[model samples]
Target chain A: MAYSPAVQELMEALRCLPGVGPKSAQRMTFSLLQHDRSAAGRLARALQTAADSVGECRLCRNLTEADLCPLCASGRRDPGLLCVVENPSDVQALEDATDYGGLYFVLKGRLSPLDGIGPGELGLESLEARLAAGEVGEIILAVSPTVEGEATAQYIAGMAADAGVDIARIAHGVPLGGDLDYVDAGTLSHAFAGRARYR
Target chain B: MAYSPAVQELMEALRCLPGVGPKSAQRMTFSLLQHDRSAAGRLARALQTAADSVGECRLCRNLTEADLCPLCASGRRDPGLLCVVENPSDVQALEDATDYGGLYFVLKGRLSPLDGIGPGELGLESLEARLAAGEVGEIILAVSPTVEGEATAQYIAGMAADAGVDIARIAHGVPLGGDLDYVDAGTLSHAFAGRARYR
Candidate 1:
């Protein structure tokens, strides 16, 4: 006979995740059903609670349960130095890898005109308002090095310029501890173009 | 600032699944929160419904919402020919790959003395009662080829012998579509030992 209706529905529902395919969804469904029912219940409740409460932070547009995210609310972070990223996860990635104690603005997406993602969709007007407040002195464009990311960065840079704020893009070069032979040509060229003077 | 408590809780709860590490869990958590809250809610509901309703079939020990699994309840399946497997997933695997229209017994786990698993833990007594009821024919041992699985199979074989039931095992050989050059020595030897006659 076929799988139970609930089991089939669970498997189908699990496929909505970013990377989960049919096989993974099936495996996850079976594993959760077989092994920890309590954990499953906790996951269900967690999803419900998070979904019901978590919304875009009013200040930075990052996922948060409150109006302002912790970074946005904290007085410790540098309000004058704002780092703009394509998504909330990028903010987390930068935080983990760097000691930059600055505030952030999450775009939630790159500017992709072909895909209908544009300035208005990314809440750029809100970002402009934040900039016009005159608190942020330097805006760091921390979008990815991809074509779409570069275009999005350029668009944000233009906005920052109009708002009379200085803008800087994060350095593109050989990764820390990377071998020269393995470094890509584009990155090496960028590194050469932006080289700092040796003592 | 740190992640919201509910977000943190959701990420932690997601790590309960097999093979899911911290990075995958974090990615999943963010994706769910950002993209599809309704799908996430459906997943949570499915988990709750499946956990509350799904249980082992009384007859075959396979997962079911009712007393008897579909295989056990169906008149089409051969009741006289029973296939025993280490877990319910194995039953699904066999069903997908083979035309074995027979009933099944799910052990849920193999015999592992180091972990204190034994005959009673596998519900072998109930299986024995089913065997003693004079199942008309053959029993198939479809356990894995691991040491614990072999030991479990042997134990079941002894039980079947005592019950005067004929038994067979799924063959061990180089897998179909496998390159012989990459086939391990143990599997190659099994293939040689089980060589078939040509017409």
Candidate 2:
């Protein structure tokens, strides 16, 4: 059906969001027009303001309006311990789920040479410079277990070894409260091989 | 975790969208800021323009930026075959799913006196005036079949009877291609009661 130019343009622009297709964009357009004009205006202003001002934190590559992110700026977090993750969302996930009181180093993406994402794109040189400055006592690798993630983690581990800093990885295993029958064979085998002695 | 003021505000504002929660809001915000700044600007402009300009169609109460929506303004559709529906979205759904080439009168909502919705809210007076003008040959009730919907249909049918216009309700039953075992008993009973003769 042909909508008015304004409505049609709104629907088309809404599709730029991930997972939003034509149907969903139509629904969103009608919902905003019918229910909340104030909310629509607010969202528009917010999008414009954030797109203009938000940038990567200078220290960790996490998204922030200031030079450093709130987590990086906070004096409460330990500077001696650092956690490496692939995306800003991953940093948020780890912060919410874990009690680790260390700083984070966001890689932005894993090492994918075929995709043209190399050490430069991931800001690895900045990370190496920070490592060589000799303040960090331990480094934690929290990247995913995919092939690219493994390569990225090993490269960071090598840097840590050269800097004479301790390095450890987050565990890979069956999740707590997960049914063993539903676990995949590869994960099960990996868990079995890395089994620890009972308490 | 505390995000920078701009980032946090963007995430919060994104939750105004239907079905978007905190995690989804965060993802949308980051995606717009990081990957598609141009899309974010376009979306913001579109939202502001639509919200500032769009209003209901004078004849059908469907959303439009002009005096009438594209369908209502078109001379091709049969004005004598007006289909009554609950929302602009329903009009869209019918247009996509059926070959119905007719004008529409959008009720916008069903009758629900308990929640303070009545004929005045649904623009039924305008609908009645059109019926009295003696142009529409049939009134098709495409409202849902819930208790409120049934009450709404009955009220409109009463108006049709007084105006000497033919009235019919859309069929309710087990959906096409649906398994009989999976059909709810209420739908089955309704379908059985409304069965038609076969050739």
Candidate 3:
């Protein structure tokens, strides 16, 4: 409360960040004001530019400043193998960890009708149109294993079937190096039920 | 690496935050772009305004957009008792934790010759002038317990002595409610040495 008007306002504005609370906000405010004003200026310009310019990519609905996202416009990635993810962060996560050279369709959110998030919110109409175009050979569902995600996957699978295209969901099981004893019952059961024959 | 130019630039700029890394930068970028463009814009404006306008307060060298920081400008605080701290964040921390109604002198940093920081960088010259003004009754050292902090406190103590002003340092001991068994030996020794007689 001893902070000046500008310092306090900056702290309040910083709380808009997802994980930044009041303490972190204050720390960030001081760190920027005291140590790195140039960095703060650069961040301000970047935020303004990105917020003003970035919009949904036309082809994949991923966030991009241009009409098409890099993966969608690259032409090097496999267009026939389309990966469906719940958010833009998910696309980044998968891209960082995997070599799946496939284009992505960002759903933005899963189907949660109770909360009024339905297929329309997930951009399923656009997905359906893409599926019906007969260009995609396979649809890969990389959605979370939540109830709404299950329903969304099922709905998308139905769309894929209607379009006479194959669909597959990413495997839900124990992680590669996870200890079985430490694994939760839900994950263990999922891993057990989806167990594969040993090669 | 699939990030577009604007998004990538935003992420890189975000890395300037003290504790944020690549993953957090990406996460923050997506959260801002996807969920809160208005918040992003607000943050951008705040950063720009704060970076451009905020400067060191004249009296105590604390950060403020005005000529003096709130604490320094407020006539209600005890100007006769000045507390010296390392940074603006320390001021906030002390304000949050304690009811010390004294004004503060922000050192910005301690004596670190290797880092090229010295008495001049910490505004010790202004502190000496303030002490020589003969209004202050006590000078409280609230700097850190690090080596440079000790040296800074010693140096300030010398200044207070030269000005014939009484100086005291905040006690360094184990925190209240801290378990003795878990407390580090150095802290325990300091606590033991600084022990007070119970009434």
- Per-prediction CA RMSD (Å): 1.9, 1.9, 1.4
> Which prediction has the highest DockQ against the true structure?
3
Tell me the TM-score of each prediction against the true structure: 0.94, 0.94, 0.96
Which should have the higher lDDT, number 1 or number 3?
3
Candidate 3 global CA lDDT score: 0.93
Task: Looking at model 3, give its docking quality level.
Answer: high
**Model 2 docking tier (incorrect/acceptable/medium/high):** medium
TM-score of predicted chain B versus true chain B for each candidate: 0.94, 0.97, 0.97
lDDT of 1: 0.87
Specify the poorest-scoring 10-residue window by lDDT in model 3 chain A: A17-26
Candidate 2: TM-score, chain B only? 0.97
Per-residue C-alpha lDDT of model 1 across residues A86-149, encoded as one tens digit per residue: 8887888899989999899999999999999999889899999999999999999999999999
* Candidate 2 local lDDT, A1-199, one digit each (tens): 6588899999999999887898889989988999999999999999888888888999999999899999999989999999999988888888889999999999989999999999999999999999999988999999999999999999999999999999999999999998999999989999999999999
Off by over 4 Å in 3: none
lDDT of 3 by residue, A61-102 (tens): 999999998889898998899999999989888988999998
Which ranking of candidates, highest DockQ first?
3, 2, 1
CAPRI quality of model 1: medium
- Give the Cα error of residue A171 in candidate 2, in Å: 1.6
**Highest lDDT scorer:** 3
Residue A104, candidate 2: how far off, in angstroms? 0.9
Residue B40 shift from truth in candidate 1, angstroms: 0.9
